[model samples]
Target: MTTRRSTLKLLAAGSLPAMLAMPAARAQQPLLRQLAIVVAFPAGGATDAVARLVADGLRGKYAETVIVENRVGGGGRIGAVHVKNAPADGSVMLFGPAFPMAIFPHIYKTLPYDPLTDFVPVATTSKGAFALSVGPAVPASVRSMADFVAWTKANPDKATFGAPPGGGQHFAGALFAKQAGIPLQMVPYKGGAPSVVDVLGGHIASVVTPLPEVLQHVKDGKLRMLATTTERRSPFTPEVPTMKELGWDVVFQDWSGFLAPARTPADVVARANAAIKEAVASPKVAAALQAQGTDVDINSPADFARLHRQTWERYRDVVRSTGFKAED
Candidate 1:
């Protein structure tokens, strides 16, 4: 029938545009050629270590070449800015801790990049906690946080803690000092390694830094962990107690993840997210990060972005409450 033929032609015409647009839509999708996971700190540090692990995991998973580039400076701002200014094509990404994204914006008077707008979180690689360690300056008998606080009170002149200047560790030390009702002086170091070194050499009474940086020293008997800034005991150090258990309400944990520039196609972000989740889920990658005291935390891009926003707000409140400001 003529009417039936016309209806069929109209149906075929309605389907033709979508069928023809499929190839063009696919053509517009970005193809990843090379990938770079930028680290804000120098190589050999924990951030770099994780970045390299991710780079290895993503090497054959997405782009042809996945390399880690250290753009170290400005306490991670330099590297973050580098990634922010990069093209939003999924070729360049930042692989580092959440400090620059969540904490620094609240502390710094002027930040080069807006964490909420400049980047899209791809995946969360790991979560880690900081350790409150006492060096040779504290007596071996002083084991717990209460004992350390008593010792500091008894030795006011030697009551000083060291942490990297303008970092979460420094703020954690400040918060601990405030909550413990101790008059402790904060000695700033350039990095965790140096701070740990000072604590080992008795230059400072204690050091508040990530557990991974001081875990080996604790094992070697060079340093003693008094408490961790974690809600619960870290699996890496089950014997250690949390600050909360000691009746101090101090709890801080840092998360590291991958972030691509904003405006990158949603599919590209999803692709990167999938590759990252797969890479982090790999046994070898998880084991490598675990060996560094980092627990793998794979999450969806939406969840990661929400986490970033939540963390930023939390840090903002902390900075406001502490009246902390970074020296330019």
Candidate 2:
């Protein structure tokens, strides 16, 4: 009896090792069957373009199939809410601008999703600065922000600037007008593309929009970039000066990145981060984004989270100072 008991004990002890190894082995398998990259804006926009590029890069990187979905409306809030309520299994991710994540919380009376608690920053895929551009209605001699301000003051009737409604670009124009001590009228467009269209048609004197949307027009001589919204000159437009350099306190840059629902498993987040970093670093992806005047900025999950927090606080103050409130 004693010998039999000893053998049974040894067998049970040996089985414990196999049981421990089972979970680790299963973890090596794919975490998801499919991956969805959700774009909060309409398709064919810059954000959607970047999301598709990353999706293409991640196609064969993992066993799961990748797809991009457009979840439009509410200035990106609708899509953000959908992702925030999604399963924490890393199957769903948000590829969107900074507004829904950082700026909306302060501007809106009640936001559906809490950016600080509802999502995890996976990686920042690209960054682009805004440009204060003047269309053909403005004289070619009005080349800089200083010159633009002087011209607006001289001709208040034609001092109108266009920007997307309730976006960073709107506030940038407002702040610029306030700082320059000019009564500049800001016309709100539904999106950047339409604003650019109006500016090209000479219906609007100037516009504050994403550099990429206006860069080609500037190159084509249809629009003139007075200054960029970055602290330094953009590499794509090295000749253009920054607003700070031109004695205006306006400096803003827009970023697009990936975010998963909060509480996703650490391993899944790590895998997604790796895939995004690789995608952002791919030559084809870099070239496509650069052609759009966007610079690649891949970061670790933790670093990206830190950046999100810092940017949130900075924009909170900005929104507060503007005293701008979105209608509930």
Candidate 3:
């Protein structure tokens, strides 16, 4: 409303302050902000720890502020639902172990969210094996799976393997027993740590636990690792044989990855996948993951998608073969 002279006078009289308050160029802004990696388990658990490590890896790469959110309930359903409905802008993702995506669909009577349809596979951060370790209850001469089976047949009442019920390890033990044609029983423990304790104390004949759980004990000769459930030998224990090599088709893995809500743009998914793979390839992340008994399992988006689908189907078939059911 003012003349040019009046505008000039106003600009001279503190217009610099108003100019300084304006935003900078868009290029200065982070590609994404407030990025969240939603974990289905509580904090302090292995899943949450993996998520946090990845979140740390993602900082300054994926977003300016990356956070790992714990949404624990309904056996990972709450976080699944949350991620399923999150904005498809790639700002929010569900970061969790493979079971929530691969096993839950076959185990639960119904899930609030469809893992296959509701999310797009990102990249797995890491993958590790489940192992079979024996305690003193088994004869020291029982070194291989064949020897263990023979001993189990002779000591049928004492042939029990401990693992958490309804977990992949439990099913792996069941499959091993079926394959070996031995009458073996499964003892459920609250967690692998306790189960490892029982195995070490000779309270249980053997245990099906994650490979890392017994690495040190095996190294110290406190326990003996008979076989791993991985399709191949674990890098952490390359000297150990796999159950498959020992004539049992038992294969199980612990994998962690992220899945974006369905309909997220393909480019965004690719970008996220590449970024995550870079984070995984970083020396810090790789070293830490290796220390935890996980391998650098990052791959291209297409490859990861294939792996994701196959793992889901594998768990479905495994659960079906086992006749496992969830309470309605």
Local accuracy of candidate 1 as per-residue lDDT tens digits, 134-167: 9888888988888989998999999999876667
On residues 57-103, what C-alpha lDDT tens digit does candidate 3 reach at each position? 88998898999898977657788899999999999999876777788
Per-prediction TM-score to the true structure, in the order listed:
0.86, 0.86, 0.77
Q: What's the candidate order when arranged by decreasing TM-score?
A: 2, 1, 3
Question: Candidate 2 at 159: error in angstroms?
Answer: 2.6
In model 3, the Cα lDDT at residue 145 comes to: 79
The 10 consecutive residues of candidate 1 with the worst lDDT sum are 26-35
Q: Which parts of model 3 are misplaced by more than 4 Å?
A: 1-31, 42-46, 70-75, 135-143, 154-158, 188-205, 253-255, 325-327
Regions of candidate 2 where Cα sits further than 4 Å from its true position: 1-28
| Candidate 1 RMSD computed on C-alpha atoms after optimal superposition onto the true structure | 4.6
Global local distance difference test of model 3: 0.82
Error of 2 at 322 (Å): 2.4
